[model samples]
Target chain A: MTNRSFEQVSALLDDAIADTREQAQQLDTLLSDNEAQQVWARYALYGRVLKGEAAAQAPADISAMVAARIRQEAPPSQVVQGRFGKHRMARWLRPAGSVAIAASVALVAVLTVQQSQPVAPEQSVEPAFATNPLGGRSPVSYNTVLQQNAPSEAERAQQLRLLQSYMLDHSQQLQLSLQAQQLNEQSEAAAPQKDDN
Target chain B: MNNLKQQHHKKMITNAWRSSITGLLLLCGFLSSSAISQPFQVTDSNQNQAVALYDEMARALRELNFEATLVRSSGTRLEPMTWLHGVYPDGTEVELIVMLNGPDMRILRIGDDTSYYEPHDEAYTIHSDVTFGLLPAAFYKNFSELQPHYQVVGGRGVRVSGRNTHFLRILSRDNDRYHYGLWIDVESKMLLKMQMMTPQGDILEQLQVTTFVERENVPIGMSDVRGIPRPPRLYEVRNLRPPQFNLQPQWLPAGFELLRAGHRRVADSGLPVDYYLFSDGLTEVSIYVGSQQQQGLPSLAMQGRESIVNSTQQNLAVTAVGKVPVTTLQRMVDSMRAVEPNATQP
Candidate 1:
């Protein structure tokens, strides 16, 4: 590509990377909110299914499911539609789409399974999802797995915060590397012409 | 095996003898040259004549009016240029126009005021010392003072620029500054060819008389050059406070002494800078002291024409610029200290 065209492409890529990072952060915040917990749970479930993990069985607590769904997806769907369906989907799908799809599938499967299962107390299912995956892990157990599991409300919040920071840092570094590569290519292309002189 | 051992022993003995002889010859050669060049008593009348001739040549330089084409050399680079008219006694209205051929088109003139005219920019003014080339003021002041330092001797005659020229060697007493050799015109006493030699006897600069005209030529005024504008008067004479040194240097190189000191405004800080000048008859050093800045101390060892500037910053930023070694300049800076207000003398 010509130098000017290359620069233009580089700038567009930079903008795309920045936009992706901003959307990821917003999704993380939306997932953490108590009102949007069920939608967030669906997204997390979808993320697990995409990574080939089994979907969580939905709780028999219909009242909680309906309340959580209304708080999470209803507002977002209205806003997304009010803006533009295709454009909103495109923005959300490009970066977080894999995790998002997995989270959705898991939540749908859980809800469908709940329709068939016997009713359980609201607190029992909440503890299963909210507590550390290895809550009953012994002291002799490897610390790596324990560290990885985002147990409790505080730990999950901290995990999301750390993830956002790591993603932002990585995205910034990638953008800088891409910019340097583009500059090097331009300089290399110009060098031959200068040598000919 | 015994035969090989004997052969090796013979070779070793031969090598040792050869090296010893070589070393002895080198020592003898050095001593012989040193003896030949030594300053001996001037008993012969011709030796006195050589000194007298040099004295006359120095005086003649201040009186004669002639046109010359000179070539100045520094290291591997050579700058050829021409100059026209005037001398010191005549209130010399000299015009030196140097055409810098290599790298860029630079035209320099030293007359009523030093000016540089380049094709890319308008003519700009310069200071006197920079414009007068590298000839020391001591040469114009007195020729006899240089006799003890430089051993002047006559050399073989040669014809240059279609005029008979007599050569003279101005050998140094020490290796501090470079040596000079000159070819003077037999009749007019005009300098034809001048050469500056390195300490190791390598020619650093050579200015030859490519063409010479000793005629009653009318002097050219500064206005004679068209398109070249007159340089504006930039220096404003200000009443400045004399520099006060809190500490004095215990030791300085021979012939060097403090000349002048004053406080002047520096460019970067726009603050009063304590400035001092020291000269060893020929070479001059300027020392400036001011308040410290946010930036780190500037590095030492920047080169000029036979000069080096060393700067160091502590509580104060001290800069010493002169034709001296970096170590010498550093020592000068280290010697500086703060003095009491009452002790300062204007």
Candidate 2:
């Protein structure tokens, strides 16, 4: 049998498709040919892999060639509907191993969230009163706690710096307000007598 | 095995050092709290005498020739400065404040003009009666004018800064403002210590004169300031344009009056903000409105007795800060209503 007949038989086994009468006639030609029967035996071994049986003697290059053929033709698999059903390895994992992977991923996400519960100091600030002795600052410093959580360190620092600048500017700078007050009251009050000589 | 022993010894030393530091900090905290526990009495006092003493201090602070070496203590910060006041031979009043710790924060008030000489910043002068130092401007103004909003009570005698002082307390008549405690020298009437406190006896800020020199002449510092030539006041902000936007505050404490309404840029950061300054003679509160939301202070944030309240409406951030109650600040922020640009306030 020719290489074309071997390819035809291989496609027929991988897809489990002899849907058209023309394909049936072609498979009939492959079954009567010699080389096509060897291709058929290799596919039978691949089929045993789906049946929970060992196929240790199967050639490694056969699996590679099948992957190459799938990439080149982009075949619409008749036996497979969803993405997982396309590959022989994934075909065995479909309804059970996929569930196990999903469960592990969800477990990891929940644990990550739990480990980060107390990380956001700004959002977690409670209504704090000035109860600190010495009448010092009341907000608890989160610096030591935040060392382990590296992502938000720079952002929290920026917020605190901005807040400080706001307080300092308002409390310290009075040039503008003084100007307004000065012009409002011009004579005989606070300081400058405007040297009206 | 020897290396492991060295590491263990180092760990033990570090642990001891940390515990000692913690113990010292706790002890300091206990001492300061105990200092405040003996409340300054706010009882029946001769209101007329209290007013007379306060009026005398305000006048002495402006007209006296003396040098006051003091430190303003608030929270964990200490700012030491020398305040010198004197009269020149040509009838010019000169007052100079030299910041002792920082780099070149000198303020000189020659009569009504105040000049600030700050390092790394342009030295500018403005026409004003007093420098906007941490010192309350009311200390140089007429305090009796604010008597309607406060009840002045004379407390027991106390010694401050090596001088016999008459202790006095000023309580807000209706809890509309912060209370004040004063210790004025009996001889010169100069204030030796002034405490701004919450109504609940929590001291927010304290300014204490550590050393005071009653000068026979113009204070040496003020005389030096007179010889230090000043550039002509050519850059003073004059012809002030009225505020463009109307951030009309609907509610204010009784006796509070709008002194100034205009636009201003925040110092250092140079962020543009429109503001209004209100004063009830003794204390001042300022309300700022700006579009930059990041500069808004957190809700009910207190720095010493200054309460800052920030609120947002239609993307505009409103900030009100003063040495008043946080509830009053929040209420002021709540009462603020933003109107159209240049619209007349109703």
Q: In order, what DockQ does each candidate have? A: 0.00, 0.04
> Model 2: per-residue lDDT, tens digit, B112-197?
77766544333445677776755667777766677688778775668897689988798887665778899999999999998988
lDDT of 1 by residue, B113-204 (tens): 44443332223343332233434444443457765556677665578766897777776555444567778888987777787664445564
| Residue B270 error, candidate 2, Å | 4.5
TM-score of 2: 0.59
Per-residue accuracy of model 1 over A10-56 as CA lDDT, tens digit each: 34333443576655654554456554455445555665767768422
For model 2 chain B, where is the 10-residue window of minimal lDDT? B36-45
| Candidate 2, Cα interface RMSD | 31.1
Model 2: colliding residue pairs: A191-B112, A192-B112
Evaluate all candidate structures by whole-model CA lDDT and list the values in order.
0.46, 0.61
The TM-score of the first chain in every model comes to: 0.24, 0.24
